[model samples]
Target chain A: MIRHVAVFRFVPEFTTEHREHWMALVRALPDRIPQLRSMTVGADVLRGPASYELAIVADFDDLDGLEAYTRHPAHAEVLRISAPVKASLATVDFEIPDAS
Target chain B: MIRHVAVFRFVPEFTTEHREHWMALVRALPDRIPQLRSMTVGADVLRGPASYELAIVADFDDLDGLEAYTRHPAHAEVLRISAPVKASLATVDFEIPDAS
Candidate 1:
């Protein structure tokens, strides 16, 4: 399986409502995108000096499924909404061995 | 629960064996550290331009639990082994609300 993680650090001015707005879109994703096997969106509770405000961790069957989920319209809309508020974005897409 | 993720990009000279060497210690973590509720260590299958070579995704009951895991002797040994091979490390620690 492929694990795709994307984390976003919001602009200093972004508010809780703005974060919830993005999270709502993320929460609604599994139903909208057929390739999304599992997804979790969470806010950072331990806001240390290096903390990121929001993160999304999702799994896909393979690279193709991950690509499809990225290209979905809902994802596009999320990108559009996040453009103004995002300060930094970090992501990783990697494959894991099949469970024995 | 608190989610703690750590990703490592190894030096160009690091080999699969070095990765496995580290992973072996990681795989042995939950047994050594009672606070580590769940842990997954995997090599990156996707070698994209921005790929990180190894990653550890682990969950803890709370911030204190996460801290204890980090301070565990086995974990410290893993860190010692990784020092020579590690190129870059990126980590994120955050709290997620109860799954209702």
Candidate 2:
């Protein structure tokens, strides 16, 4: 399986409305995007300087499944909503080997 | 629970030996760190420009548990081994709320 991990640093002005919107969209994605095997997303509870505002981890069967999830219209919609208020973003996509 | 997610961009010269070493160390952590709830780690299978070589997600009971794991000597040892070969590192530690 391939897991895509993304961390988002939203603008300082990001509010609860943005949080609710983003979470709703992400939570609804598994149903919209068939290739999305599973997903877990949450916000930072700590006020540490190194903490990012949001983190998302999603699993797919393989690279192709990940590509499909990225290209899906539902995902594009989420990006459109997020782009304006997003300050920084970092992502890492890796394969889970059978053995540890 | 708090999830500590870290993505490592290894230096260009990072070798297979380094990969083996890191994997073995990470895989052994659960036995040594009592605060660790779970962990999943892997390397990038795709050579995309955006890819980070290694990704790790470790869950703990709470922020204190995470702090304990971070201060654990075994984890510090792993960090010492990885520092030289790591190029860039990005991490996001977030709380998983009770609701979706």
State each model's CA lDDT, in order.
0.79, 0.84
lDDT of 2 by residue, B1-100 (tens): 8888887877777787878778779978988999998888877776565566788899898999999998999999998888888887777887776453
How well is each residue in A1-100 modelled by candidate 2, as lDDT tens digits?
A: 8889988888877797878778889988999999999888888776575566788999898889999998999999999988899887777787776453
Best by TM-score: 2
- Report interface Cα RMSD per prediction: 2.5, 1.8
Displacement of residue B34 (Cα, Å) in model 2 is 1.9
Deviation (Å) of A60 in candidate 2: 1.3
Can you give the lDDT of residue A85 in candidate 2? 94
Listed in order, each prediction's TM-score against the native is 0.86, 0.87
Binned by DockQ into CAPRI classes (incorrect, acceptable, medium, high), candidate 1 is acceptable
